[model samples]
Target: MKNIKLTIEYDGRRYLGWQRLGSSDKTIQGKIESVLFQMTGEKIEIIGSGRTDAGTHARGQVANFKTESELSPLEMLNFLNRYLPNDIVIKDVTEMSERFHARYNASGKQYSYYVWNDVIPTAFYRHHSFYVPQELNLEKMEKAAEKLLGTHDFIGFSALKKTKKSTVRKIEEIRIEKNGAMLHFTFIGNGFLHKMIRILTGTLLEIGMGKLDINIIDEVLANKIRQDAGETVPAAGLFLDEVFYE
Candidate 1:
């Protein structure tokens, strides 16, 4: 058997999420598994680097699966693309070392949230970006974002449920860039918790709108309470930008 790694990109508007939840739910993993099962007539499990919430999209999501098929990388890519739905595309496929697990081996991940700031929402960006009518103070947003860098317990930004692991994570970078009516916030972190990015985005939006004091970021981080944070933004604006591995 060989371990095959796939680099996938998808528009998550039509899918439940990345993972398969139920027999009836249409998901990225479910669609890929269905295609693999049809092509090989074998039950195969694909492991994703991470999960994206419903309506979230991805540009460089990585996944891996084990198979005994002797097909070459290009051939497998073509075969999977032919069977997979149009929303999900297998951008590349390659054979990897047997011990390379997609999730565990990932070094870090990058996510970006897009916002359309204009008087009227654009029909073309309806599904891709969050439309906000109020003008955002980018300077204030950047100031608040800087505080989020480095290692910290992100309990306030995460789901209010206990997990087996620690909520402490290191954010390597946070960048805010705007062009025209498009505003993008990119975050690179060692790892993330459920809805962490969206919550962070919402909090920053509050700062931008002058609803929340930029200095309140310190209190939110110190409080470590879910309610202390801002609202969780819609998943439509979030995208799994990239996954990195060594």
Candidate 2:
């Protein structure tokens, strides 16, 4: 058997996230795995770098699976693309060392949240970005984002209902950049809890809009309460930008 790595890009607007669900639901992983199973005649399980929530997109999501097939990486990529739906594309594939696990070996991940900040939202970007009619102070948003840098317990910024084993994760960088009417909030972290990025973005947006004080971040972190932070932004605006591994 050989372990194969795949780089994938998908439009998550039509699916129920990456992982396989019941037979009725469509998923990115399920779509790819179904094609692989049919092509190789083997039942293979794929491990993704991370789970992207429903309606969240990905540009460089990675996954790997073990299979006993003689197809070259290029051949497998072509075969999968031919059979997979148009919304999901297998960008590249290569055989990797057996010890390489996509999730376990990942060193860090980068996520970006996009917002269309204007009085009138553009139709072209409606599906890809969150529309916020209020004016945003980018300088204030940048100042607020700086507090999220470094290692800290992000309990306040995660979904309140998760039973995760831990909430401690190191954020290497947080940057807010603006292009025209679009604001991009990018975060790089060792790992993330469920809905963590969206919540953080929502908090920053509140600060930018003068709804929440920037200093409130300290209290929220200290309190470790979900309600202390801002609301979770919609999943449609979040994207898994990249996954780094060594």
Candidate 3:
């Protein structure tokens, strides 16, 4: 058997997130797995580094699968791209050790969120970014983001009401930048909870809009209350920027 690794990129507008749902074929995993079945003549399952929410895009998503086929990496890559939809691309394919697992071996990940901070709606970015009409206090938002670094119980920021696993997560970096009318937020961390980035962005946005104070970060961390956090931002603006294995 050969352990095959794949680097993938996809426009997630139409898919039902990254997981394979037996009830629906409109999923990134299902789409790729189907092609793998056709090529290998077996039901091959690909493991992704993480799941991307519906309408959330990915620039450097990674996945791996085990196969008994004799196809080389280039042939597998070419065949996958030829059959998979145009919105989904297999950027690279390579052989890996049998012990390599996409999700378990991942060390860290980078996510980016985009916001159009202008009154004029952008036809081009309408599907790509979230729109906020009010002028945001970039300084205040940056200050709030700084407070979110380090390890903390992010229970309040996650969509999950409860989980057996610990909510504590370490956020290594939070960068907020502006270019033209667009505001960009980049988050790098060991990993993130479900919708944690969206919730974190929503909290910072509230701080930017003067609805929430900078110290609200402290309150959320101490209380661990989900309702006290900011809105779970739209999925359109979120992207899995990259997945790091080393």
Can you write out model 2's per-residue Cα lDDT over 154-186, one digit (the tens) per residue? 888898565647788999999988899999989
Instruction: Return the TM-score for each candidate structure.
Output: 0.98, 0.97, 0.98
Which lDDT tens digits does candidate 3 get at residues 1-246? 999999999999999999998879999999999999988898998999999889999999999999999999999999999999999999999899999999999999999999999989788988879999987999999999989999999998999888899889999999998999889999999999999999999999999999999999999999999899899999999989899988
- How much does candidate 3 score in TM-score? 0.98
lDDT per residue for candidate 1 within 121-187, as digits (tens), equals 8899889889888988999999999999999989889875877788999999999999899999999
Q: What clash count does candidate 3 reach?
A: 0
Better lDDT candidate (1, 3):
3
TM-score winner between 1 and 3, please give it.
Answer: 3
Candidate number of the best TM-score: 3
Model 2 steric clash total = 0
Clashing pairs in 1: none
Better of 1 and 2 by TM-score: 1
